[model samples]
Target: MAEKIIIGITMGDPAGIGPEITVKALSNPAIYDRCSPVVIGDACVMEAALTIVGKENVKIHPVSNVDQCLFTPGIIDVYDMKIVDINKLEYGKVSVMAGDAAFLYVKKVIELALAGEIDGTVTNALNKEAINLAGHHFSGHTEIYAEYTGTKKYTMMLAHDNLRVVHVSTHVSLREACDRVKKGRVLEVIEIANKACLDLGIEKPKIGVAGLNPHSGENGLFGREEIDEIIPAINAAKAEGIIADGPVPPDTLFSKARGGWYDIVVAMYHDQGHIPLKVVGFIYNPMAGKWDAVSGVNITLGLPIVRASVDHGTAFDQAGLGITSELSLVNAIDYAIRLSKSERIK
Candidate 1:
């Protein structure tokens, strides 16, 4: 194969806007120009999406493997997972079928990546609640990729230019998230973030780890977590020559990252990191009652196989209204391609 970067794009929750966005995204001939893009999803659903979006000329190419792909414009190469009964999929409703199918799309992409069938993967948004409801029980795409790819060590890297962040605890309850801010996990994630920064072409990255408590436990005035777990973690990472600092106030560390003081920040939990990133990335339109744009890609840092995703969830409410935006999906594909390129060069 000619280092032919076969990019596998998983169509997310069919009940949501996954099909719509996948269709809309490939309307660009340039996506095919950069890489031979394939969709690990349903053909009938994509057909509906194309019709809904009114791009009747856009055609779907079903392939058994990426090697058989035609890198042609106006045509999408889809590996038919055949997991949905489109009649049963209520546009905006969560279904076990949708959840299971979403899980399969992701799972197959990993298998193909490991088997060298695809060079990289760009995942669309999947509904966590739906996945769990179907008993697939993953927190999100990061965990799913980490587990299936047999990546024992991995970190979630959220990036948009210099406003990058990695998390120590994601997908846990608030109290559990607080408890998980131990030295070992903290140090692990710090190292992961550092490596990720290097992957982003930063030679020597500066990382600021956010404290688990307010005012970094206020120097034991408010809490002792900083004294007990966080501080030790920072010491460990620094001891090994990682430019890690923090137990800094969470409120201030983000501003520092935004101001270019640090290459990235390590957040304690999912929302802690995600909130600031979305605030910077997601563009909302109140009048239209929609998010008009999203600018960040969620990269799984320690995976053996390359995976990146839209930093948004399944827009179940906007399923086939024909206004779903593929900008985020397109961004995810671009980032996946870039990461794959970086890894290939190494």
Candidate 2:
């Protein structure tokens, strides 16, 4: 059998559900069969989470470096960053200390991946407000990874089952999102989306580009973005031998993509892509009064190293309750493994 890939997982906000879900996900022995997983966070934080979740069999093996990891099934090897004081942290609350700790964990994991110490990186949910509060001043993980890796062009791709969507403009206001939808940016994202699909095992990805306006501007009746920017981008992508079809109406694009009409959809903005993915990935039971499942993986495209993250955020309300789902983290790990394997082959 081939050796398992080493996946470095960043424990998100220490006060959030990140440690809880990381412990829960690593508890399953089958994960060891696929990859050697390591937690890049404070060992004390993970210990608290294990106590909260009541996962006793799993042991936290603190390590100073990757080579110190045992890769054992029941033992979770944690590269202890020790950036936070466990006594000061309170679950379900956002603070600068927690934010700084989370940021440090992610930075360390990225450094490991780039240094060839780890095959890929998987991130748990981090609170944006808390991170900003700590003066990191980045919008989210994608932005941080891009800046740290010196990647000039990158896009966020979210996947759930067969539905895949990539964004042209994320972490921007709605008005700014529309303004950023020019031919150059749109085409750049399309290229990234195509390459991302190929990395995920698609030989020739079918691309669907959503329009910024209604009915793709109704032939210039609603807006001219399709006629002016989107169509030209699609034509240029085709000219470059990319299998792309777009300027599709935003209303219909997702439905078609969900039905497997396209391998991926190039969404015009953040909400345009996120709303649909969350609709299908997030499951809430009204009577249960909590989420039954949250399943999706967020992949960053056009980077030197591989990164896959949970689609959900830090559920402050459900932090210490131990009800946060590990399904998304598991999916993100699966994606990281696939992408890492593809990168190795290339």
Candidate 3:
């Protein structure tokens, strides 16, 4: 029998729901069947999380390196950083200690992956503001991965089941997002999107490219971005024998993608892609006054190492309550495993 893939999971900001969800997700014996999951963060934080999430039966095994991991169910091996101060830590609030710990955790996981100590990595959500306060200065995990791995051309891919969307430009202002749209960048994203689908075992993936302007610029009526940039990129993708479609109107493109018309949609920018993906993935129960499920996977395509993350944030309000959903983390581990196996095949 083949060995289970080794997946390194970064316990995100110590003050957030990261540790809570990490313990909850690891409590599932099914996950151990697929991957040797290891948490790269403070063992003390994880210990507290196990109790908070009511998984006290599960043990926290601290390992300084990958070879030390037992890789067994009911035993979550933490590659302990021991950086977070449990006494100083407060659920939901931002702190420099937590921020620096979060940054270091991510950095260590990337280092482990680059060194081939792990097959893939899954990340819990980290607070951007907190990380910056710690002086890491990274915009997000994608940027951190790109920098540490020396990947130049990469895009964020968010997936909920069969629905997937890749951004041409993410983490930029609306004005900058519009200005960032160009034939070259759009084509680059389309190419990446096509390859991403192929990686997911989609044969002859149909790529749907979205327009910057509404109604896809109404054929130059609403805006010329469609004619000037997006359409040309689609045509260029076609030239490369990629089954690329649209400059489809932003309003309707996602609906078609969700209905299985396209394998993946190439969004023009950050919110353009995030809004629709979240609309489908994030479910809130009004009567219960809590989320029923927050399920989605955020993948970084074109990275040297496989990385997938929970689509939701730290959920500061719900952190210590142990009510934040671990479904997204479960989904992320599944993706990381699949992507790692795919890499092994390659």
Q: How much lDDT does each candidate structure score?
A: 0.86, 0.93, 0.93
- Give me the runs in candidate 2 sitting further than 4 Å from their true place: none
- Candidate 3 shows a clash count of 0
Q: TM-scores, in order shown?
A: 0.95, 0.98, 0.99
Q: Candidate 2: worst 10 consecutive residues by lDDT?
A: 1-10
lDDT, candidate 1, 63-166, per-residue tens: 77777777788988888888898888788888899998999999999999999878899898888888999899888998888788778877888887679889
lDDT of 2 by residue, 1-346 (tens): 2277999999999989999999999999999999999999999999888888899877999999999999888899999998989889998898999999999899999999999999999999899899999999999999999989999999999999999999999999999999999999999999999999888889989999999999999999998999999999999999999999978999999999989899999999999999999999999999988888899999999999999999999989889888888999999999999999999999
RMSD of each: 1.7, 1.0, 0.9
Clashes of each: 0, 0, 0
Q: Give residue 260's error in model 2 in angstroms.
A: 1.1
In model 2, pairs of residues that clash are none
RMSD of candidate 1 to true structure, Å: 1.7
Comparison by TM-score, 1 against 3, better one: 3
Among these predicted structures, which one has the highest lDDT? 2
State the TM-score for model 1.
0.95
